[model samples]
Target: MHSKRIRAILAPVATAALVLASGAAAVTAAAPAQALENGVARTPPMGWNSWNTFGCNISESLIKQMADAIVNSGMRDLGYQYVVVDDCWMNSTRDSAGNLQANSSRFPSGMKALGDYLHGKGLKFGIYQAPLDKTCAQYFNSYPGATGAQGHEVQDARQFAAWGVDYLKYDWCSPSGTIDDQVRTFAKMRDALASSGRQILYSINSNSVHDKTGPRRNWGDIANIWRTTEDITNEWDTGQTNGYPMGIQNIVNVTVPLASYAKPGAFIDPDMMEIGRGGMTDTEMRSHFALWAMMASPLIMGNDVRTMDSATQTILKNANLIAINQDTLGLQATQISNDGTRRVLAKKLSNGDVAVALFNQSGSTTTISTTASAIGKSGSSFTLTDAWTNATTSSTGSISAGVPAHGTVVYRVSGGGTVTPSPTPSSTPSSTLVSAASGRCLDVPNSSTTNGTQPVIWDCNGQANQRWTFSGQSIQALGKCLDAPSGATAGTKVQIWDCNGGTNQQWNLTAEGTIRSVQFSNLCLDVYNNNTANGTTVILWTCGSAANQRWSRV
Candidate 1:
């Protein structure tokens, strides 16, 4: 999957992001201004796509069924607003003069008629296209020929918008080169869409927005949502390929880089979630959904909603997870830690509670005792509310998190405001946390200090660059990591690192009580054989039920 220049969507670490893979290039129009201001992109994008239910067999009449089902199911009111059609709607044949023609047999009524039906139902309609000349299906598309110039690309986008399309799912199936050019091509359509004034929701296929390439591909407020993965399939029967959908690992990997990019106009889409798709255990789907919601990633479903079982519906409609996404503050979640099957992600919800997740990505049952402090809160003992379960939970000095493998433990954490999060950043952030005076140092060695040399743990003494917030158990001093001990290099020694708050330095607290360093990841603290000593030599080890590894900030 090659990425276009414009597509800086998240890509697999090795390949980076393949911008605008496919199902992009359709910009209906700028959506009404009010819709976006209300955090439309913040919540998981609840809706349907043709690929899941209909695949390449899409037709005008079939889309009508999807729209009807969405309206009849009352899911639209629940936030399933956009009814999108994936690939294979294009026809290779042109009329006598060279105009694109609707495949008469498959779509007898034409696209306008279908748009009328969906718009009539009070739901928006989405169409798909690609930056390349042909879609992945080998069907017709727009791309540069051997000459490397988009033959009829710009015109096609205009036509789609003219038909009253609302959402555009652009893809970058077979582009010529570089994500920058791909973005410019999409920009052409984005500019064309401006002529229509539709404010269409632009959703590029996964991989157009690789996080490594830099700040969201100079899109300049063009596209709305960029995919961060390769194509996701709806069936587990498929091989472990791009189509497998987003697992917890994908969310954990992609969300950190993309979180800062989320704003009023655009979002980082981790492709469509495969929660209802088979292959994943129920617990796994819960974990997947929980993480996606916490990260505030786009929530397009790759499952057949028309046949969604109650079990699936229950998971999809969890008011707690949905509320976390709908939270007005609109901050996205970041990974805290993972204990084998157990993984955790945390975000500050607008309603004043921190949304915390204890997930079982392994899909097997497991016990993980997580601490509250790791999830960006203060206090030793406190009461908790299970917003997902719709009931209050027991509050002790700490929380006992037992999650089924593939399941999740989501909480709406609330307590007295013991402290504020890390201080807000100044205009241009710096690597050093320059305190007004002296302050305690974290992630530093027990005692070490030499300018440009690694710093160490010591009580605050009005140090100029020590005061910092351990937000989400992550050091926010200059937005970098105070890495775990012995993790200095790939294997040198772990030490607190510098920052601009990149993924290399984020850590999350697992629901099962354990501390995780975001930068020095997966490895947990192990007390010397579970010894409970002030300086028990916290060797880096996988998370377990050892009491020594667990610590709480009062």
Candidate 2:
């Protein structure tokens, strides 16, 4: 890990307790500071960074080439703007006046000149810095000297402004301090940028690949964009490379749960993208780009743009996915369900459309599905447009596809009215409930009338225990309704209890064949662990496209 230090600042005890109680890293030590209202990154910033592809090998000429390619390849028209030169662009040491300078050998044209060249081509300029005495490469790559901003936050901010820097990637390379100290240090830079007489988009990496402190929640309040996971490498699934979790799937897992923190101006960055990096399959690359767009993450390309192939260009310039990422609603897609191998995410667009992504993580091709209602949509008719191929389909609600291994199928669904939970249907006749995975009946063991009797998948038997009736959203069998116990959570075993008309007992029989609990719509009646053996238990798990969670009436 790169080493750095933070000047300490005491925080109020009560404020610290409040943040800690909420399960967030305590960052209340400093006086409250708001993210700069620079009117940029209202939607997640779209740009390119040199780190993933070039690392510390950046130079003025290479950045110019990227800028020229972005414009000539029509990427600029599609919103790829900022051309950021990551660490190593700075000299190993400060100048006589204690100001940081561009490495004279690589950036002979100078920082301002490089920025001017990009601006001349209708692009923006971005740069990197650390809060400590050395950047990650300065320590790890043995690049000499103390180039970090540390106590010179104001001076560096002004210098960046003077150099026409439109974005700042403030990294937490090596830091010595409490979480409070880190927050204070980052805030000082934020303040410096705000006072720098320019609107620099503030991006910070408080949790580097080497840091184990996890992401701090208050980052949304301190910077426009904040890194939520370790640096992402060009791989499809989790594997450690240089101590960082390297893969698209690993970063997605780390970022999905942080959706609530993203809004119009604040974005939860999962790190720059690795699309077209050659380490992942084309399918996996599509999945990666779609996932980032769905999550409202910054679309900072880390691939060498100057020589990208047509397929790479196509994926990078996907207009529909780009629009979804730049949606004015600025809401990050929520992981509605994940069954280890299959995951479903949904985000609402400002124009009354909902974007849904069905991702298959397993090695084999699998059928994945979700319903409009499950994704917070309902209507008599809906239009589904495949985000990649532009294939259009109409449906009442069902959305499904045979997604390839490590692939994602994204759909922009429109024409659905906002969902309004309907009252229970009037006296629906009893039917045998069969599990799609087990081909067995949902049976109450021994025909037990005892309350709290858990349901299980058993051999299809023509008995009262296997007969279930739907009434006003309740699934009744043997004089009881299927219920999720109070305070029930994912993995909670579902049981038969007296139907008191509670939300937990109400279920939405979706068109895609899922029986979703109304109380927790994101969960479904899952055959435990996808085990098809007779007498397997039934529990509520996240609503995924997995067959174990699917059910049918007979």
Per lDDT, the best of the predicted structures is: 2
Q: What is the C-alpha lDDT profile of model 2 across 153-246, one tens digit per residue? A: 9999999999999999988765344466778998999999989999999998774222211253447788899876566778886543222554
Candidate 1: where is the Cα deviation over 4 Å?
1-44, 94-99, 139-154, 206-220, 234-248, 339-341, 362-364, 378-383, 394-397, 418-554
TM of each candidate vs. truth: 0.64, 0.71
Worst 10 residues of 2 by lDDT: 19-28
Residue 66 of candidate 1: its Cα lDDT?
Answer: 68
Model 2, position 554, has a per-residue lDDT of: 63
- Candidate RMSDs in Å, in order, are 13.8, 13.9
TM for candidate 1 is 0.64
Q: Count the backbone clashes (under 3 Å) in each candidate.
A: 83, 3
lDDT of residue 72 for candidate 1? 77
